[model samples]
Target: MFLVTDPPEPPATDAFVLEPLRPDLIDLDTEAYLTSPDVIREHSCGRWPVVGFGREDNLPLVIRHWSDHQARRAFTYLFLDPEGTSSLGCLYVQPLFPYLESMGADAQTLLRYAGGATARVSYWLRQDSGPELAASVAERVDEWLRTSWPLDSYLYRATPEEEFTVSSLDRLPLDRVVIDLPAEPHSYLWWSAQVRGGTTRMVS
Candidate 1:
């Protein structure tokens, strides 16, 4: 229900940097992932968080998956401070698989929305960080994606447990869908954008 109005600003002095996830860094990332549930509880929508989060038994699997950054399958990033010494948060990006995968659509459906270059993204900032920091990290990574990938538009979605929030293209004629999986109910307030003449813009 809110929107982002201002242009991106330079990151703060203690700004966070995004790095591909790696196995060597799991020990450092443990705390962030473990504490994520509490943070999610406080921040995500419905005020309801997932259970069994932060269980030691799950760390190994979580670490193993994100350890590799597969551009096509998925791109996971660990957010760290400027010094690159600690984990502050994380960001994940991939195609619209999670949102559109079970729709039973044919190739034409994919072409209509993706056209070979649309992406889906998710992110979370440490509970201790200011919301502005989360916004900045999103902007920085978005610009990076624009320059480094073949994307025409990217879809930023709220976690299923959270209320839908959009910025930048909040007022544009954007694509949307509610993913009501039997196990989980969530909505996607997707925003689409395209790069034209060296500038990224909402596709409206």
Candidate 2:
């Protein structure tokens, strides 16, 4: 922490911006990262650094701060720089596969791109921040990532063999059993080949 230095004034922009979440060293405290999991405590696939983030004033960061207030821990802020206030985004990084967990099945597959270290960013804004201002803030972030992180750093979707890192589970473990469920209870269990779009079939 920077010892709660003087709050920064609102950044002037026509779009968004992103910053890194470095705990040590002198960080302005504007980095975007996923705070926690909707299910598990963590979604660690590998390691990622703060890459992108955002903040929309209309949807200010009031909720996050409030949650932190309840927990008495610093809330997870986005890497996006809010317009103004003592409020600032705190971004961080993890891995690509974990980030997909938040995006659902279709999104999870995207994790295959993450090769080495990946980054998960967030967007944050103060209660007073607005859309225009937030948009401006978010744009700056995109610009930052374009310049800062190399294309290879965030290739999460790439296979390990391709990127030299096996991300997803390969062969099934002995203890696990696959089950097919139907949308309706009365309906016969509808089994699709490969769970997704593969040829392996458990039920014909």
Candidate 3:
């Protein structure tokens, strides 16, 4: 018993928009264009917890429909914890779920976003290298990104000539745009989506 009325579309959890986020605020308010007090306390409040996903062959690859478990739509937002943005810290968003429930698409968006993704040398700290040592590299990489992203997208890694620190925020595309929140810095190794939750099946 089969009837081919209309095939079917992909899944909202897939719809996404990557806007610069304020470190002091929670996930994009989808309300205010700038930071909000309520968002800060609810999400950031302080370098609280960071949820990471996707893989970076070079740039962040936002996988559409992260899985069947998620609920809301998501995207990456880069922000700092003091009051500005950081070039070193990368934020990657997961696929949307609600959108799928709405009979939306997941593939086309992922494909499109992937085509537009690319890591631009927005800012970098070359404390180990020298002052502005990354200027050339940044320029080169940014150019490559401008081209590559439109095709398959890309990610850029801090070269050996780059150094990352608090001062790195000074070179953002926007002027002192990011806001930092109060929080105790903690150390946690970044992992992939697969390793995030599933228990390691330590087969003895």
Task: Choose the strongest candidate by lDDT.
Answer: 1
Which candidate's TM-score is highest? Answer: 1
Q: How high is the CA lDDT of each candidate model?
A: 0.55, 0.30, 0.26
**TM-score to native of every candidate shown:** 0.66, 0.33, 0.21
Q: Which ten residues in a row have the lowest lDDT in candidate 2?
A: 165-174
lDDT of 2 by residue, 131-185 (tens): 4544444344434433443323322122112111111111111011122222212
For the record, the alpha-carbon RMSD of candidate 2 to the native fold, in angstroms, is 16.7
> How high is the lDDT of residue 41 in model 3?
26
Off by over 4 Å in 1: 1-14, 41-58, 67-72, 103-109, 159-184, 196-204
How do the residues 114-170 of candidate 1 rate in per-residue lDDT, one tens digit apiece? 444566776766666665666566566667655556566666766433322244334
Poorly placed runs, candidate 3 (over 4 Å)? 1-126, 151-204
**Poorest stretch of ten by lDDT in candidate 1:** 1-10
Rank the candidate models, highest TM-score first. 1, 2, 3
Backbone clashes in each candidate structure, one number apiece?
Answer: 1, 39, 16
Model 2: lDDT to the true structure: 0.30
